[model samples]
Target: MTQIIRSLDEIAPNYDVLFCDLWGCLHNGVAAFPAAVAALQDFRAQGGRVVLLTNAPRPQQYVAAQLDRMGVPRDAWDAIVSSGDAAQDAMFAGAVGRRVWAIAQPKDEGFFTDIPEEWRDAPPITRVPLDEAEGIVCCGLFDDLTEVPEDYRGRLMLARERGLTLLCANPDVVVDMGEKRLYCAGALAELYEDLGGTSLYFGKPHPPIYDLARRRLGLDDNARILAIGDGIATDIAGAAGEGLDALFITGGLAFDQFGPDVENPDPARLAEWLALRAQDPAYSIGRLR
Candidate 1:
């Protein structure tokens, strides 16, 4: 039986580090959740370290700026680690050579800022035609608001025919933006894989990002770190794979499936849902507060 927690105060002392998810748990795509911020502040006040681990395809600085714009308190977290950081490491470590095709928004160019001048050719990362590219880097949809994954079928097929390896910076398929659900870079990557194309994903549910977070937190291998997030496949599964405790937030992406009672969900239904995914979160909460 999973314990349903209404307040994080109940388990704050049991863990030393918190690996918190940003997109759905801390805020919707539009704004910050005040209670979630307050909870992290209170946790930090009690000497617990909070690290924001997100699947956002952009660099940590970009995520910080977005958090600031959304009015999330600066003190709510101690550090931020993003999938883009991991992807940058992969790119520099010879994941993709000089010339590459980029399928991302203009604002997501921060993923390539870490590449040194000498390592890259004239144009480090190009958004030009795929035919002139050696590899592909997908951070997000060219236009997420107006486009879906299906819109890129033709492009993906072309890349597949050329046998280009696609590096997916973000592994999340969808994220809740206000009341609407937006497709992420992972969706496009999945489509590419379906078309017999090779894809390298760098994000949650993959061990690399968790390893980065563990190093950032400076915690021992056996340290009690609690991961809190809404995505069952990404957040909960990632934590479980890392052998860390996870706190499932039902109010985020899983709210609709879990039901309308954000504060209290049917235990049987919740258990059944988790069982299907083979995940067992240490604790379940409606919201971070």
Candidate 2:
């Protein structure tokens, strides 16, 4: 492994493309991190392509709009790719008799607004209600686990036995929803798979999302690309799997062992964690302004 001894100051000169994860890295899904936004701007000013790769189960456009509204400079990213776009692609151009009972919060349904006209007029995609459906497309798990009626589980299994394909838009088990830890669709989809059903996953730690990340940059020519994210399981693992340098952010979505995370931990904690486990990241500590 080639260790680069990186800090935010040295990130851009060191890499040609930077693949960053949204939600945890740049924003808390509700606001943008000023320093995080500045880092991308600095990288772009230095001639690097910035691609924000996210597990958000919405199309790239939606991600861009959200960032734009949050004061994230539009040019901070050269392009964006998301798990939602991948799932939409997997739908095979809206074939007849195909339906997806969307199991997610209402706000995220906007991602499906661009569905084809041929699909249907009953909202193209209906909420994945706890009953019969042709197939399931999970955007997120319902927040209250205890309130998840048994009827919901039955329908999932029934659909699976009938050979329905359960497509997962976002694959994270949970994301820090402000101060509350809300469940994501990935958790429910995993449970379904455990019951002998197969699932199509979109997002980081999955192949398609990374492929999109590379494509957006037209990556090649020894153009070093760095993937920066806040999670070990998704961003770091996904970037490493795709043979890209990874910069892990320790100051975002993740919570400490007890209570809520009131403050963000710094990059030194990332180095300490890696060193304690005899692991190493190409860079260490905060690199962005």
Candidate 3:
């Protein structure tokens, strides 16, 4: 059945916990969506718990600080959990004292600096390497992991033969990057798994990250949660899979990929779009602002 909501107020009475999406649903990376911010603020004032759930590949604290700068008040929500947090947790899990091979941008290497000194930071290649490491942790893609070539298969296979565990910081296959659709880390990780390498992913649309939010927010399974986001694959699919209602914000993540604007999305197209992924978020909202 189809569902619709005209205003944020309509959501409060139906939900005790709100698992809102960032980016398009709340604001563009550079600016905050005013309507979204107000809605969240109203939710908290009514004694509801608001947990900001995002697929961002950065830590939750960093995301919070960035949002704060964009005008999201500290009181806007109860807590947050980002894909990056899960990546960090997985990176530290047994990986703290062990060696790891990473394929990420220069800026992203810091995520691994916290690893124990005893382990090694195996030399990085856009593709796999000849030398072995205890595990592999991926953050961003080189040439965008989404567009990797057939040749890289051999490199991934080499890592697998060595039996190294693989880590994917961003579990997105692709994302709406303002102007273009770019590949994400999960694409390469999937290939590695197909190559016989073991891979672990941390990000949206995944049950683990959602599970973490469940504990932090103290939200019961029966709680009516509204998850709003831009990406149908991660935000909508993940939340729906977890038995929560969701709102699809058109222009946030895949704004450019789908059409002209994410802020004002075409609901008919969106509904059909998400149906392919089996994602049926409760409503299709224009945007936060």
Top TM-score hit = 1
Position 26, candidate 2: lDDT = 85
Which is better, 1 or 3, measured by lDDT? 1
Give all TM-scores, in the order shown.
Answer: 0.94, 0.80, 0.80
lDDT (0-100) at residue 85 of candidate 2? 77
For model 3, state the Cα shift of residue 69 in Å: 3.6
Model 2 — TM-score against the truth? Answer: 0.80
- Whole-model lDDT values for every prediction: 0.87, 0.69, 0.72
- lDDT value, candidate 3, whole model: 0.72
* Candidate 3 segments exceeding 4 Å error: 95-97, 113-130, 142-154, 194-196, 254-267
Most lDDT-accurate candidate: 1
Residue pairs with backbone atoms closer than 3 Å in model 2 (clashes)? 8-287, 140-185
Cα lDDT tens digits for candidate 1, 99-149: 788888879877776564445654445445689988898898999888999
Predicted candidate 3: what Cα RMSD to the true structure?
A: 4.7
Q: Give me the overall lDDT of model 2.
A: 0.69
Per-residue lDDT tens digits for candidate 3, residues 206-238, read 887888888877767677787777777888788
RMSD in Å for candidate 1, one decimal? 2.1
> How many residue pairs of model 2 clash at the backbone?
2
